[model samples]
Target chain A: MSPVLVVLDLMGIFVFAISGALVAVRKELDVFGVLVLAGTTGLGGGFLRDVLIGATPPAALEDWRYLLVPVVAGLVTFWYHPTVGRLERQVGVLDAFGLALFCVVGALKSVEYGLGPLPAALMGMVSAIGGGMVRDLLAGRVPAVFRSELYATPALAGAAIAVLLDRLDQPYAVSALLGASVCLAWRLLAMWRHWQAPMPSGPASV
Target chain B: MSPVLVVLDLMGIFVFAISGALVAVRKELDVFGVLVLAGTTGLGGGFLRDVLIGATPPAALEDWRYLLVPVVAGLVTFWYHPTVGRLERQVGVLDAFGLALFCVVGALKSVEYGLGPLPAALMGMVSAIGGGMVRDLLAGRVPAVFRSELYATPALAGAAIAVLLDRLDQPYAVSALLGASVCLAWRLLAMWRHWQAPMPSGPASV
Candidate 1:
């Protein structure tokens, strides 16, 4: 990976890890729980995508830095959860940035590994959302994305845009920037507007 | 994979999917949720292991049969849930069978992928428990294995035994059978005796 991509990936992981740790703290989980949630949220999406694409032992497993970032984030959250909880808005913005970066990177990587456009885009969304889902599961809650604001749709759209641009012979830098911007902009808009995904119209039958 | 192994694998998937669908039904999730849970429970463990081992597109994605089995299982449970729910004891027995089959198969597959014995055994336990964890997460519950009976430990033991026998040049059939039997027997004993894993000794710190 290029230096810029690597930097963005690590930043994304850091932000996601912090979010996971915050959730763990709120749930009154132990320090071990905080660390585990951090690690899972930071790396779970990439791990899922890589495993699906046959990338074994994932980059997180191969590099100490990747593992270290989450630990640091977890410890920070553990020690300063009150402050972190107070800064929810800022964290939400950072999470949007992370989501944008993950979607584009995940799509491009899937394409590199020979996935078709549809599957690549889906993988991108998965890469953006899978970690959060795992985190919520470990934290004993329904995943926020499944019931919250427009999150996955933006990720999928960004991924699709990236894949389309790449297929149209756009430079990697151009495609990635445009794709990430699309996701980031859409996510921010959803947050600002308090947009929600559609829910089941009727009561769920038992 | 051999025909017998394939059959066994399908059977395991069927049982796991049934369990997942049952959870969804009890949770009053929509039909979509039922199918999603079934698919996740049937395939989640292998997906995790395969990703770690660098096996891409996972067997479920590669073969139609693998995908078909879970869908069938989900539909069955969804339509016949009252009957299926009433058959909880029988279902529990079948779940033990599925767990036993998965631990051995998962361990052997990890070994084939050149993992060390310890990792292979761990992977086996993961393969046996991963799906149920996913199911619980989707159903908005903590995973039962983390706090319930001696589920994961038995899987680890069976997987370890399989790996050890394989190292000793035991025939694959012999190793697999013995390993599966160990898991099945232990799981049954745990169920019959109402055995539980140890939990945290005190209240979780806030």
Candidate 2:
């Protein structure tokens, strides 16, 4: 990986981990639970994508740095939850950045592994959202992504753009930057405007 | 896989999928949600174990039958939920059988992948319970395993027995049968006697 990509990846993990740890703290889970949630939220999406795409042992399992980031985040959240909770808006912005980076990277990685563009885009959305879903589940709540937010659609769009650029022989950096920008812009706008995904149009049949 | 093993694996998937579909029905989720939940519950455990053990592209994705079982289960439950829900008692019994089969198979597979006995046993328990955990999360509820019942412990015991027997050079059939029997008996006993796992003793710190 390029140095820039590595930095971005680590940043994404850090922000995602912080979000997870914050949830754990709010739920009054023990320190162990906080750490577990942190680790899962930071790496769970990539793990799910890798497993589905036949990339075994996940990058998080192979690298000590990947594991360390979440532990640090968890400890910080556990120690200073009140302050962390107060800074949630900042964290949400960072989380959008992370989501943007992960979606593009995940799509590119899937393409590199020989998946078709459609599946690659799907994998990208999974990579961005899977961790948060796992975190919510572990915390005994419905995943927020499933209920609200225009989160996954943007990730999928970003991934699709990246895949299309790659298909047209765009440089890796160019494709990544553009794709990430699309996701980041969309996510930030959604947050600023308080946009929500449409719920089921009618009452669900019992 | 041998014919018998294939049959047992399919049976386990079928029962697990049924349980997931029932949950989706109860939640009033749409057909899409029901199908997704069924697929996740039927295959989630094996996917978790396989990823941890570095087995990628999970067996379910590779095998059409594995994918078909859950879809069929979901459709059946969606169409005939009243009848299916009424059969909850029988489904619970079948779920115990699935648990037994999954624990043994998961342990053996982990051993094949070169995990240590302890990790192998842990994987077995994961294989038996992981699907249900995913199912509950997707259905917007706390996982039953974490809150109540003697679920994971029995799976661990069964997996441990299988691993130990394998280490002792026992025949595969012998190890599998004995291990599965232990899990099935313990699970049924737990159900009959209304056994529960111990909860945290003191009030959790805020």
Candidate 3:
């Protein structure tokens, strides 16, 4: 793997882990619990992706950086909560960036393995959401993406765009950059406008 | 799949869901949480295995029985706690049987995909433990297998035997039976004797 790509991947992992630690703090979790949440949220998606792709030892287990990145992210968030707490939305923005980056990476990896476009796109979605799903489950809440938030929609859109760009014979770098931009923009717009999916009226008016 | 295998698999799913629901109840989770935990514990392993093997839709989403099994299991446990609570050890026994049987099944499926014995055995272990790992993570507790428990050891042994037997040209039926027997016996023994892997201690203590 290119050093640049590896660095980007690690950055994505760090952002995801910090986001998870923030959620745990919001939920009033202990330090150990926060670490567990952060670790799982950072590595869980990539672990699932690797396992499904038949990558041996799984990336989460093989890479020392994968282990340390999340722990450090968790520690930083835990120690500087008062200051970091003010940047909750900024954290969401960073997480959105990670989600976009990881989704493109997952889709490209799937295509490299000769999977069909549909399967590749699904893998992208899985990689984006799997970690958060695990984090939510551990935190005893419904997954944020499964709720009114437009979390997964952005990832799906970005993946589809990346795959389409690739099908058009675009350069890998260009496709990845555009895909990340798509995800980040969509997520930011949704957050700024308070966009949410419609919820059913309560109990049929009793 | 054989009819006998089908029935046994369904039974295993039911029992595993019950096990998950029991844990949720102990944690005082709500009804939705209970269902989510039970469903994940019952189906997560097989789902991970199938997805890795490129099986579409996965078993949990394909068959109505797979979905219903966990729901019913959870509801039954929720409604009849005193009755179900008294048989916790018996549940462990059933869970061990399920682990053994599923390990063989998972290995056979991996082999059918033309993977090596090593990967096939690993898949079997994944199919056996993925659900419980998800459950423990959701319950905000370390997974039992991650600790000193002999839980994962039995599954590993069963999977290795199944793969080895298959490599030796044994019939699937015979290999599966032998593998399941080894797993069940080993797990039951571990449970009965409170067997565990040795934990690390300080240098002086060791």
Candidate 4:
């Protein structure tokens, strides 16, 4: 990855790690649990994508910066949990940016690794949400992504746009910016407007 | 892998997949969800261990048999969920056998990939529990191994024993049998005797 993309990736990890740490704190987990949760939430999606795509020793494991970001985020959140808790709404906005970035990055990486566009886009969606799924698993709750309004859908749309543009030989920056902007705008709109996916209709099957 | 080992692996996958399918049924997930949970539970542990050890395109992905076992198991369980649910206790015994086998298989594979003895053993424990961990994650619950009596402990111990014997140049059968037997005996005993890991002590810090 280019230096700029790497920096953005690290920033995304930092924000996601903070969100995970805050969740751990609210759950009253110990420091170890806090650190573990933070690291997984920040890096787990990338790890899953890398492993499935035959990239061994995932980038998070290879890069010291990646390791350090989550640890620092975890420690900071652990120490100032009350302050962090109060800033969750703000943190969530940053999280959407992270999601936007990850959707593109994961999709691009998958394409580079020879995945088809659709599969690459699916991987991108997985990259955006996989961490929170793992985090919810460890925290003993349902993954919010499954229930959240317009979360993964925006990521998928963004990834599809990115991969499609890339396939058409568009400049890298053009594809990335457009994809991320669409995802970010859609997510922010969903949050602001309280848009939710419809519940199962006539749900008496059980 | 040897033919014998491959068959054993398939059997393990079949049992684990059924367990996962049963969980999905109880959770009232649709058939598609049941199949996915089955596949993940049957294969997730090996995927985790293989990916961490730099094994690419995990065996399950490359082999049709590996994929078939889980799908068949899932469908069978889905169609006869009531009977399967009634067999939960007996099925758990089969699950222990699967865990025992996985502990040995995963450790040996990790060692082949050049991990240290301890890490290989840790990988073995992961192989035994990872599928269930993922199954519970998707099912929206805490991993049973984390809270169950003497579950992961036996797997880890069994793995340690296997790796240690292999390091000492013991015969493959000797190491595999000893490791699997020890794990199976310990786990069954724990279940029968109601052994439990101690909960955290002292007043609530929160």
Best by TM-score: 1
Q: Which stretches in model 3 have alpha-carbon errors above 4 Å? A: A1-206, B203-206
Candidate 3 backbone collisions, by pair:
none
Binned by DockQ into CAPRI classes (incorrect, acceptable, medium, high), candidate 2 is incorrect
User: How high is the CA lDDT of each candidate model?
Assistant: 0.88, 0.88, 0.81, 0.87
Residue-by-residue lDDT tens digits, candidate 2, A1-206: 99888888998999999999999988999999999999999999999898898887788899899999999999999999999999999999999999999999999998898777776776788899889988988898767775456787788889989989999999999988999999999999989998775432333234
lDDT of 4 by residue, B33-129 (tens): 5766798899999988887887865767556678778989988887777777788888889988999999998998899899999999999999999
Candidate 4 deviant stretches above 4 angstroms:
A1-47, A56-140, A144-206, B200-206
Best by DockQ: 1
Off by over 4 Å in 2: A1-44, A51-108, A114-125, A134-140, A148-206, B28-33, B137-142, B197-206
Q: Give the per-residue lDDT digits (tens) of candidate 3, residues B77-134.
A: 9899778989998998899998998888988887887666766776798788779878
Provide TM-scores for the models. Answer: 0.64, 0.63, 0.58, 0.61
| Candidate 4 residue-wise lDDT, A1-206, digit = tens | 78999999999999999988988998999999999999999998998888787977788888899999999999999999999989998998999999999999899888888777866886798788888878888887766765566687788889999999999999888988899999999999989897765432222212
**DockQ agreement of candidate 4 with the native complex:** 0.15
Model 3 docking grade: incorrect
Flag clash pairs in model 4: none
Each candidate's DockQ: 0.19, 0.17, 0.07, 0.15
Q: Is 2 or 3 the stronger prediction by lDDT?
A: 2
Model 4 docking grade: incorrect
Task: Rank all candidate structures by their lDDT, best first, as comma-separated numbers.
Answer: 2, 1, 4, 3
State the lDDT of candidate 1 residue by residue for B1-206, as single tens digits: 89999998999999999889888777665555676689889998998888778677776755667878998998888777877778888888999999999999999999999999999999999999999997887888878898877899889889999999999999999999999999999999999998998777889999
For model 3, how does the per-residue alpha-carbon lDDT over A1-206 read when each residue is reduced to its tens digit? Answer: 78899898888889889878877777665555566578879978877877777663455544566677888988877777666667777778888888999899888888887888888887887888889988887777778887856888888888878887988899999988898789889988888888887778678764
